[model samples]
Target: MWLEVLLASVLGFVIYWFISRDKEETLPLEDGWWGPGVKSTAKEDESIRPFTVETSDEEINDLHQRIDKFRMTPSLEDSRFHYGFNSNYLKKVVSYWRSKFDWRKQVETLNKYPHFKTKIEGLDIHFIHVKPPQPPAGRSPKPLLMVHGWPGSFYEFYKIIPLLTDPKGHGLSDEHVFEVICPSIPGYGFSEASYKKGFNSVAAARIFYKLMLRLGFQKFYIQGGDWGSLICTNMAQLVPSHVKGLHLNMAFNSRNLSFLTPLLGQRFMGFLGYTEKDVELLYPFKEKIFYNIMRESGYMHIQATKPDTVGCALNDSPVGLAAYILEKFSTWTNSEFRNLEDGGLERKFSLDDLLTNIMIYWTTASIVSSQRFYKENFSHGLGTLKHERLKVFVPTGLAAFPCEILHSPEKWVRSKYCKLISYSYMARGGHFAAFEEPTLLAQDIRKFVALAERQ
Candidate 1:
């Protein structure tokens, strides 16, 4: 009887010990999975600190001289007849870039905006900040942050800045006001690339959140396209409270599987608002996109897989750099123009403008760093990454350009973005809508802002 009582007592003590330990293990701080510990503290700050942009007149002059020297060399016979510009035509185009293009004039144009450089996460980030010349009696200007994507600089918005900040240029009210801020994504233009690997879109978004806070913008709007769109979307997800609204030209919903409705329903047909007549217009071009991706995207695959290896090659050869960047301008904007002289580059941008953009990449020696951006973001499986779906409670607008590579149908976009208040099917323009059709782009922005103000 005594032995039985002792065994029962021992078992009872074991059970009680485990129950007490379990309760201790699950304290509130450890139990709260979705709580403050997961959030980054970079978003909460307010200050406008000044940073310097270090560039000398001598360095600018040297870049001009080098560009001029490159122009003087006759173009080598175009050995590859892959896309536009036969060898004979390419020779002339190279000649124009060498002799006729004015780098100094373009540099002066860039200097017109107030450019600044500041350090974030040990890397220098370059930006252009433009405030409205005049504001209404007591009203503060709305803050707008603009982000540019690959193969372009902040220069993309040069023509639209005046119109947005001072609508007198458009015969609209002089009181129309905005304080615009445009940043160069790391490694793209003047912004220094991160020394460490794994600096993907999420990291960039985090840095930008800090940037917005540092600028004293507690609440602001964001506008972006291309990789810029992805970064802005990530920003909205990371800190939706601070990003009051989002305006995008290129939209991607990495979260919602429902966006695949059209692809699954019609077996990838009838996308991009294709009609019977439009199908005829699009069939051959669609085939070409597939073909081009197969041939040219070998580089993308390499960059996406092993960027450092390919970046070494791009860093060395200027001709290789030109071929790498220029081909996208040919196929992406419009495939029909792919086989023409200058790759139909003149259709959307002036020869001078095109060369200026190319020179920016060349002078900075950033082709490899820029390409590495793709590798860093996508080399790892895109499917496995934990992407955030933004429940944006603020106003949002989208300007869908016709010739954009990927189409964001309204239904698909609405799934990920909750506060889509306005959308426009742009009449005509390609991927580089802001640079290619600034007036139309600016007008759309104005219209959207006007409507948002009323609400």
Candidate 2:
């Protein structure tokens, strides 16, 4: 009888383990006030107002005067972007920016799409909303909120937005038309910077979630690459039922299994569910993972600790700001570009496009506040945040770009995102997927949305 009782207890324990393991978890939906002073008891304004990208002669002339005043430093002989943005290439870039680049034309380009701003938590949030020119006969356009990361703005989505919203016009299927909403994270571009402290990713996520609901999207899709990846992940965790699907080109995994790679080595990574591609991208762990992180993360250390100190210089000088920001555009695009004299920036992007993005930061004077976002997110330290500990329970799609700063394997991503339904090994791209490879990213999004809709 005792033997039978022991058998029953073991069976009950096994069932309980499986049930608990499969149970869905969510991050708490928390409230926050990022505006100056204490929160008010009165109802917040819910009006969405129109906004336009305007550039005046004063702004352009000031930028040119700064460019003319820039003191150029000679780079070390044969030192490419490895050391940083090469001074020689920068001189050339500055010449074009000062003489040829047209800020007025770019502003016109920015205003091509419908732009709007709405006050949320006592701050004005800026975003561009684009709807399909022609929706499919029986289907309404799916609402998608695309968030931008640091060193980038809502402009990154310009090329990809058209493809997603007007697929048929772009020679793609209209089966999955989308109404894309690209929002500048508060304190980034035209969006109002937070006046209060403690405005981290969770707070940003909550604000963007509120932005979507105000836009009348009860259920919508969320996609992001850098900070956007973390914010969207937080959104899915904070409100899974509202987020129909989550898609990311870059994913952050706190439960990373990279430590085991050295112990198991390349051949046995399969044990950890790493594909051959994952092994190729991650292995020689010393160079690819360790040294690369050390090399690329110098800016992060400063941004997370003393952003204001460096941001002052960057904010004041357009030339200094270009070098500071464009360096990432080079190395992060493909680390190999660091070996090239020009940092291979114009290979995947045009100087006009690149300069326009820089202009957004320059004109807005948002560099300091944008850098503070790093401190706000990292001030408390990593893995301690409530959202970081919880697993996202929404359907997720990951596009593992080959040249991304770090490659996160499907197994590691699945550990954090419980409902990872689609994982694709992208053909070629890096950190800035939408800006660099819009067609490929759009194709992947289409495929992911189809799979997600079926579910």
Candidate 3:
């Protein structure tokens, strides 16, 4: 009888083990050659070359000439930014760009930090590396890889870099001074564009992973918003062992509890791990969250479907390019900005900063290649990719800025990041948190890093 009981216990244990087996999922870490035509037989150069951002009289002259010749299309009476960028406002921005906006000074500001480019996957990867001038005694500074998203460049992080790198000098706590590395997404800014098709976020992630390894970093923290968010998430998935923590101002969702929770969650959010702030920001579901996504996502739809078509016009016309890109700066910064003349653009950002960001695409002449990134990633449709279903196992942090294009709750974020250590409902900011509210972003990054280090 005792022998039979022991055999029965063993059989039940085996049954439970079979039913509850966990999937040891991982992103496939692969390499590719992204150079122009054919893969070269010789090994690609691996040296890190110092790169300076230079603009000449000819470059500025050509830009001014284009702006001067841009044709004006008056906005419909009382029509604000409702129909893409208001033509009336474009004229104001054009006049400024043609007369006062100084590309030379902005270029000098961009070059203040050390810029370097190293070949990765046969493409030149451009990045800015800044180290803290003076770190607190007895502790080494942490390494952080900050990535910029679409319609943005390494310039987006310029304001926030100083705060993170030299917090003490900037009148902040020196608790977590970071050695920041901001890299331009391939095909954006000065980075070389991938020639062959099939260059998606995962491929970019693999290339960045190799970049980190080459930079002498065995492990580091990764943070991003926009495309930067997806790239950083992919890095965590591809090499969880190498990632100490992952922080994002944006959450990439494959479909989670967000749809279901929005309605019933208006009251029961706390029961679902969402704080009151999350509820306030997320509720009234149909207008704030639902319509907001639909309204703002038109650009995404075109970019994903027919990037080359629109990119052609944008590349040729500087005023058109500024209008197209700056419109995002207005709307994404505060959806209400769309209702105001000038799109309330100068309220939060200077023309210098806004125009400088537009200049990255214009000067590089990479608007077409930059837009193709959307096509390459979604050209095959989502879900078909492996990382879509996988969860990131590394320590995670999130800053859900109030005016983001769409809201993401803690419960929704935790579904993908199983080990989320920090989730902050940022006081005030929008899509470009670093650019709009550098101090808030810097404080949050420091907070998240401190939490991550405890483990």
* Alpha carbon lDDT at 180, candidate 2: 98
Question: RMSD for each model, in Å, please?
Answer: 13.3, 5.6, 6.9
Q: By TM-score, who's the top model here?
A: 2
C-alpha lDDT score of every prediction, in listed order = 0.67, 0.89, 0.88
Most lDDT-accurate candidate = 2
What lDDT tens digits, residue by residue, belong to model 1 across residues 2-118?
Answer: 654454446445534533332111101111111123434554323334444344678656654654444323334553335433445555656676567666777877778888877
Give each model's clash number: 1, 0, 0
Worst-scoring 10-residue span by lDDT in model 2: 255-264
Candidate 3: regions farther than 4 A off: 1-24, 263-273
> Where does candidate 3 clash, by residue pair?
none
Listed in order, each prediction's TM-score against the native is 0.78, 0.94, 0.93
Model 3 C-alpha lDDT versus the unseen true structure:
0.88
Model 3 earns a TM-score of 0.93
Give the per-residue lDDT of model 3 (tens digit) for 1-455: 56544544564455346423425477988889898888889988999999999999999999988987888998998889877799987877888888899999998999999999999988999999999898779988889999999898899999999999999898888888899999899999999999898899999889888888899999999999999999999999999999999999999976353445555535556644677787778777887888888889998899999999999999999998998899999999999888887788888899889999999999999999999999988877876777877878899999999999888888778767888999998999899999999989989999999999999
